[model samples]
Target: MPLIEIKHEGLHKYRVIKGNDQYVVEQKARVQLQQWDEMWNKKQEAERKKIEREKAAIEKVQKKAMAEQQTQDAIDELEMIDNTLIYTLEIDDRIDWDSLKDLSDFKDPKPIAPNKPLYSSEPQKESYKPKYKLWDKILPSIKQKKIDESMKVYEEALDIWKNETEKINSKYEKEVDEFKERLKNWEEEKESFEREQKEKNDAIEKRKEQYLSGESESIIDYCDMVLSNSNYPDYFPQEFDIDYNSQNKTLIVEYILPDISDLPTLKGVKYIATKDEYKESYLSETVVKKMYDKLLYDITLRTIHELYEADAISAIDSIVFNGWVNTLNKATGKKQDICILSIQTNKEEFLEINLKLVDSKSCFKNFKGIGSSKLFSLTPIAPILKINREDSRFVDAYNVTGKVDEDTNLAAMDWQDFEHLIRELFEKEFNTSGGEVKITRASKDGGVDAVAFDPDPIRGGKIVIQAKRYTNVVGVSAVRDLYGTVMNEGATKGILVSTADFGPDAYNFAKDKPLTLLNGNNLLHLLHKHGHKAKIDLKEAKLIMKEK
Candidate 1:
């Protein structure tokens, strides 16, 4: 059963409240109720607006869908009509050749020509002229007159021949006399020429005797005396050591000099000699050797100049190598190594000499070496170093630490420069495409030594890079760690760089993964590919690593 509820009544004394206070309480309560009602109305209005907006959005989507469907339906109906037309055309194959034939021309027709002559005709006649008097008709009388004239002419010719014979005899006698005089003059001239030649031979023989007997202090002195007597003072002293057993007498003077550097001016000197001596001199060993050396030097210089002229710097080493080899071949009785060394030294000297040749010209300016040695050393790092400093990612990677070795401190400095150069090359080749690169020293624990970002804008995302400057082979574990990092970072690719070669397992593991491994040889190739050269040798690098 439901419990019965009892109502309690208040005392009548409590009903004595102020009239204004009751009205104020009632008004305050009414205001609160009105506020709540206004709030509710606002909420309802907002909800209604939201519903209307949703309905409008749905209508917009529906209209767009309907428009798209209408376009598709139009396309489909057009396609169906086209198919029906094609079917109807395909079924209609009947021909109407009878209708196409012309009714006016059904029979073969004959060819007719206009009535006219093919050619104009007229009576033909030859235009001819006849001679009145032929030579045979007039010759009989003329022959007699000619015979009489011939007899007279023969008599005159005989008289003239007798006179002419006497005059020709006299003229022949005078010519013979003149010829004899000319012969005598020629004989005198010949004697003079012979005497002069004999004197020249005597002088050359004396000079030769003086050279052979060591009477002259030096061959150069004799040559200078000989040349000083003539116009040219800068004559090449003959090399007299070589003996030639020729029918004609030959004078050979040996000029002793340390090197061929001073041979330029000497090469231009001319010598005046008798024909016989000149012919005999060609067979002399001294002449042959001098000519051969001069020729060789000239050819080598020409080839080198041609290569330089063609702007072929890569061929310089090959030129040097071939030049050294040829020089060694010519250097008989000399030590091979010494000859090679001399050739190398001479090559360097030749470079300067060539420069001097150009420098002699008034318009030519002085040229420096362009630091080829330094550039060559840095070549192996060029591919790794970005030419544009702004594009280099590892520009701040390795700081210039303090000197490593005092004795080879320059080498240490070079190494530092090379390190920076390598970093620059890597930045250019690997990170120039708006990719990010981070370089840091490997921690004691040996995780990732460096990280690089390779972004693919079209596909979206970045790649990870790990560089290791190890002297030994990079192991598989490093590659594995890089792969893991790549996976963790959600990268599309990974790269591992090492100064040394990569281990077999490293490559095998990276084969399937989107990983690129650059080892020592590859690194060198890349450097060379981009015009970077390795200044330090492998042995030197190994030694430095060992020392470290």
Candidate 2:
């Protein structure tokens, strides 16, 4: 007989002599293996279902227990209420008995008995009477005693009321203390329940881990076997060296590439190398220069975008500060200016670059000059400008006279001279139409400063003016006060002139509130409109509102 072997999906058999019996044995072994696999799967499924049913039963029991606890809490609250009502009733009963005692003392006939003997012998003689008649003297004393007794009774009633109130308060305090203690105990019990639940969950998790351990062990074995025979390169790059030549001040990087040729190249990988200078060790200038050059060359070799993606560049301006001269050339050079290239990325980016480099210098210089003392000196001053010649908006020219020293000479400003400049400017800008202008001092008595009433009959109306010389932020409160003054003075429109800039909040408050806020800048513009240069820039004032 020749050697023979028979193989099946689940079993194998070998025979030294060739025979058909080996094939039949292998087939029977395959059927037994299939049955074993089916039985193992069914056992695992039944175990999972049992665990789920047990968890549902535990949850249902917990819910029932919580419901019972709530019911018990309600019954306890009702008992507490009943005890409080009983205490109140007992206090009321004691008060009633005290009131009855006070009434009995008033109605008693014993005090009248001593007076009766004197009245019974009154007919005997006038000489027999006591020095003071008992009826007259004793009756007054008795009446006074009754009054005093009544007051004492009233005081006793008040005392009882106070005591009862205190007793009720004490009861409430005791109840509150008990409630707090109960709450603390309830919280502790709830925590204990939670801890027990967590322990149970942990136990279930441990059981699941044990149940899965065999399958996990088999899968790990299979994975190890597959990986050992798999065709893949496991080699990777380990280290790299950056070398700099001192003689020529040149930089060179020697990096080991991965042995796997299929991987892509890493272009912007950062390599940080440190060179320490100790007190005992001295480095030559040539070495220092070489190191500086190496740092610059490495930093400049890669663009900002590549360095950013690779996380190689730390601070955005690190290249600029480390290698100042090379970075400047690269930034401003015609052929390879990385700064301009960075700018070409976007318009907003270009603006930011310009602002950081050039415009910020002036602002920084200004800020540095404005130290602690001089920071607040730039107070805004708003000068009232008028519209024309013969304008009644200002104080009367003849009434606004001044004395020249002690001499008998009078100095005055005519309305024509004051109004001529304003009228000419208004004519050039607007039209030759004239307007009546009125100027008056603003009063705390609800009156405006300057009211410019148009001369045109069809459009003539009042324009209220309020000039504020403030060193702080003009708030909404001031605007509200001005609006009230305008409404009271019967003015249709209002103008608020301030020497300082309005805070954004103040500006928002004034919107559509029938008021126009003219700050230092606006005041200057108005002056310029009237053909007069503003003597001040009120916008530079140290206003109360500083941007956060």
Q: Name the 10 consecutive residues with the lowest summed lDDT in model 1.
A: 378-387
Alpha carbon deviation, residue 539, candidate 1 (Å): 4.6
**Which pairs in model 2 have colliding backbones?**
388-419, 388-423, 389-419, 392-437, 393-437, 393-438, 393-439
What is the Cα-based lDDT of residue 241 in candidate 1?
18
lDDT of 2 by residue, 278-341 (tens): 1122235454343333222222222212222221111122111111111223335632111110
- List the global CA lDDT of all models: 0.41, 0.38
What is the lDDT for 270 in model 1? 21
RMSD in order of candidates? 50.5, 39.8
Best model per lDDT: 1
TM-score of 2: 0.22
